[model samples]
Target: MKKIFTILLLSGSLLVSGCSDWLDVLPKDKQSTDMYWESSEDVEAILAQGYSRLRTCVPYIINWGELRGSSVIVPGRGTKTGLIQNFQVLPSTSTVQWGTFYQVIGMANAVLKYAPTVMDKDASYYESRMNSHLTEAYFLRGLSYLYLVRNFREVPLITEPYVDDAMPNDVAKSSETEILELIRSDVHAALATNAAKETFDGTWATKGRATKWALYALMAETCLWAEDYEECVTYADYLINATAAMRPVFMSTPGQWFNMFYPGNSNESIFEIQYDETNYAQGSGSPSKVFPYGTDVTIDSYMYSEPMTLRLIDEYTQHRGDEISRTYYGSFAGTAYANYPDNGIIWKYSGMGVADREAVRTILDANYIIYRMADVMLMKAEALIRIGGSANWTEALAIINQIRERSELNPRSEVSADNINEATEEMLLEMLLDERDMEFAAEGKRWYDLLRYGKQQNFKYKARFKAIIMENNLTAENKWLSSVLDNDNAWYLPIPAEDIFNNSLLTQNPYYE
Candidate 1:
């Protein structure tokens, strides 16, 4: 799903496909890009195409080998079979190497370049509609780059539409600092123009597109990763205190919070990749690759592939993944074999059918939300601790407890919003990372969690992970598969080779060599 949809945008993104109005201007440009930019219907086509770009998180995280929030403990996919299988990775065949992100950057470049032009020419109603479309472009672009820099370590920083511009010719990799600046700058641009929050008149537009809070979420993430803790606190503040109607509260239970990823029904979600089960066609976007752990779901259906591990299931059960633990979950993990008492198949595929290990996950209706109310509250808590210091345990612990209570656990006796003392920096860091783990378990936060700690203190997670893996039953060979750090290279992924070849002016990423 990540490789496929990330590239499909240049093919169908804000590029505007099925529109007759755009066809009128067709001959002047292409039949499509031309016909869609001159009229009201043209605005709709761009919007439909723009909204079509709401990319999900499954592709970015799952394929890269981060596990989801299933309470399941298995070797990461990359460690088990995807990236670490051979002593190497696929080059041309791997879209994630570079192509996927470029496509997203391209789509954003084109839409931001064109959406407003059409709005200026169209009617007032068209202008209003295009306003949201422009914002969506901004949000989507930031998302693409966020993953690009995180995974590849750095990227080609494309802000404008791709062209053979003779500017710097400097396609050299930017530092994480520079990349983060790009993200914050883009987010600021979106917030200035996309003042479209609480437009939720029970319309798909509000749900399908990014809200102002979405920008704030991006802002929080950008600052948090950069370790600008106080700034992260401020951004989270915008989301919480902005609108009176939109109260920010983290979901209290794991089922209600985590199950939101099933298909629809994610009220806490700020920006999500909306999927439609009926449109499982390969040409249309379907995320069959990332879902289905234990069920009848087959890889043959909708081009799905990937198998679950007994290891993952056992871990979940060990962690108390039972009906009593999930009072809100309809089908607890224990109910594995309603049909066959002992067979626990793929866990939860978002697609319609449960076939086999290779079935296509032919459903895009399952939305992947990038930000939610829960994330904001939790991030605020982390930032509060960073700013207020160990003495600020009460402020930070309140946020941590909200996430803990959801998992049916009690907060540490020492920390709370009211009766708290101080925390050791290590204790606060551990608490923040641990709470972040539960809050963003399956959402791709784990990889970054490792990186955040790894980059600081000279990549110390190598020793910690080595120690944990030994007790965690991660065999010596398997430990390496999880993308764990090595003393030699720090475990930062190499930049995709293709990116460097295509742009001669760009230098190869620093650490890969």
Candidate 2:
């Protein structure tokens, strides 16, 4: 096994410089190999760099998770994003390069391999603190793989750090099942740590770092993706039950919902990538750049991506009305565009106000929340619905009603637990999906939700998913998209052509090939 000294020299050099606010403690000057890992601070600096690497993937997350879905539109006919929304993505699309995700995985692998040496070197670095840092490394690595597996379907799973240029680069792809099992294993390791306590006394660290609750959230979400309904419900219940007493994770009131984005790290936030403008900028990936905000709604030059679709806007209004809290103002802007409600701007990340757009964010440091209490609640509900029984349906309905109540919308009165027959069960499922659509619109979840819905039970709802694509796209494009999406392999992105050219073991996704 390589010693910590050499590991630091080989891997730690890549992490010495970062821009995150918490990463300020890292040494600006390069340290000698022997001097590194002498204290717990050294371990923490590596972990912080892992987090910073994760932040770089947010733009790809937003693009992969939303652009193809029926929520927001990307402008510019020849732009990469425009091609994606139109389902014309090729293997050479620049957005599909997943090197940043691998960088995050590399940082985590380094921490997991080298951080333990700090306990021996520093008297103050106890087992508990070491375990906490290790848990965070597992979280970051697992989360990055989750994103990769979801987007590319099959990807190279590299668990060890690349210590030198001589290391083999032609790693073969792992099946989705294999990748998911690794994620599960990582989650289990994270949860078993003694330092994986639920909260950091409601501080920013609680939401910013990995904790027991965050582990459970990841488990629940991954289980849902894997269609392990019982396991999903079990993990979700861990969070639901643990937070019951202290209520550490509660839904933010509608009036205060936007706070979850601007000046982020709200009570509902389980885990989010931290960003501070003065120290760390979101750069081109900033929400202001992706979904640019301006007083003039019709200026196409100002828009990098197209505005939120009117269908999404109508769904919000139908569910929550013109309430200033979440519907009209908090989630979207440009209500003054009465002639074209379809041009409503996504306001969640770039605006700060309730009931009205009070101020547009110029700093563009909004933290990209990965999981929150509301999303977890919906995951549990969807799991229960998949399990399928009157009691389970009833519980799921209650959860849905609770979320709707928080949003100041009426409880779903049409579907009842008593009459959960086949027809009503379908209705309940659509209702739950609609609630998710309304609640999480423009939050980079729409496409994944649609894909999950479509792919479940061997593409049972695939038509519904295709119809959504048709509904949101131009009539002319629908024929092409519908024909392309007929093959299930098209749903996942093509592995970038550059990666295939560089790696002998690589293979292009069948649809793209």
Candidate 3:
């Protein structure tokens, strides 16, 4: 909590540049409190900083979102993600620290609180522009809280910026319901702004910053997580029927699909954390470093050293014969099944071509995509299935088939829509889950998708969730891991011990305590 109050410094150069150069402005000095909120560019710098801080959370996102789920093999004991993979997470584990997210929230709060005053000081800072900046602030804060509530379940809801050391730091955790309500409110507020247009004039700003499409995507995702099926479907349709200029569509060919990663900000990207190797170098924190692809790359330098599980690999091979664009030499790399143990590298963020291993990316600045077209399509399909009806079932199947066709797989044998029942619903739900698994593998979404499924209707799919774990696990401690997953509270991460010690009002999750 004390860390949240630390003031973010800005450079004088930041006030004179345009949006494109905003990220280049590094912090050089703390601003005078009376003189800072006088220009629109000052607002842009803090918004850019919000994005910069969000990029720092990518490593944690990938680790927490994938390692705990059944996709990759476990890391060695001394590696950073090993504890998470082994289900040995403690409050002291480094990955569970939520400080970076708070930093993002703090930047957003500063913008929301002070950006309005800019209009009073500068004649050029119009109301429309101020509203646009405010919209982005709400979107960033809402998006940060969404990650927090998902991982921690209950967390201290900090909205106002802490400007000085004298501010109180002992805020207590809010209930999950309260946190979710706030997220919903923020999304709605953002949507009401004039700046919430779907596409910005520049492609980079459209994808890198929050747009109307991004706001709708956030609402759809939040509604799905909250179990508001009707609302989820409605918000999803807003994106599904977005204007042609901004609407994201699937890549028509396999080679083009790789564009979503390599040069990023593809037609399909709704929102992604922008990283330019020229100005914002990824250093050792790049996705290429973590999921490196060659024999020459040393394992000790990377945090995760395992290949995709055979279970996930077979999912592609068995269903779509020779998944040229999405599996094997595509989504992951290896000559053949025999070479998988040492060579099944995650190729999405590292490879320049689907089939060519030699075409590896030299620059390590692949944008971390938060949402894309396929993700929204699948989300809408899931919500429709949850709503449950003959009409809804038929629509969901059509959507699923569209995705399947894009992946080069045959359409699933159709269930009679008129005879829709619990059995057909369950079968279709499984198909949707598998499709998501194949579509978003190693993209930091597998674990959250499983959690949403398992927690639906108060653990209705709990047995199925355990079955997935049992089927994919090949470790010596499989039984122990299964036992740990039996406790519902065990699914979420514990609040960090340092945060608890720093703020006496903070409490550990009961499962950890």
> What is candidate 2's lDDT per residue for 281-331, written digit by digit as tens?
444565555566654544222221333445445545655544534566555
Supply the global lDDT for candidate 2.
0.73
Candidate numbers sorted by lDDT from highest down:
3, 2, 1
When sorted by TM-score, best at the front, the candidate numbers are: 3, 2, 1
Q: Candidates' TM-scores?
A: 0.74, 0.89, 0.92
| Candidate 3 structure, TM-score to reference | 0.92
Backbone Cα, N, C clashes tallied per candidate: 40, 1, 0
lDDT of 3 by residue, 255-321 (tens): 5666788778998888987777755454355566566666443323321223244544554665554
Identify the runs in model 3 with alpha carbons over 4 angstroms from their true place: 15-20, 295-323, 334-337, 414-422
- The TM-score of candidate 2 is 0.89
Question: What tens digits encode model 1's per-residue C-alpha lDDT throughout 1-513?
Answer: 122222122222223232212211211122344444565454444334444433433564444534321222333334432342222343333524555456556666666776777765666645556666667677778877787777666656766654323334445567767888888888887777545565543333455556776778888987877778888989988877765565334556555643455554356667655554453322123333454434443322211111223333333454444322221121123344433212323324342322221233444455555677777877777666656654455667876776666655566555454545544545665677666654554454655665565555455445554443233323135545445334323344455566555556555434444
Model 1 stretches astray by more than 4 angstroms = 1-36, 40-57, 65-81, 84-95, 125-131, 163-170, 200-204, 246-249, 253-255, 279-289, 293-332, 335-365, 413-422, 457-462, 465-484, 487-490
Candidate 1 colliding pairs, count:
40
Error of 3 at 285 (Å): 2.9
For TM-score, candidate 2 versus 3, the one ahead is 3
Predicted model with the maximum lDDT: 3
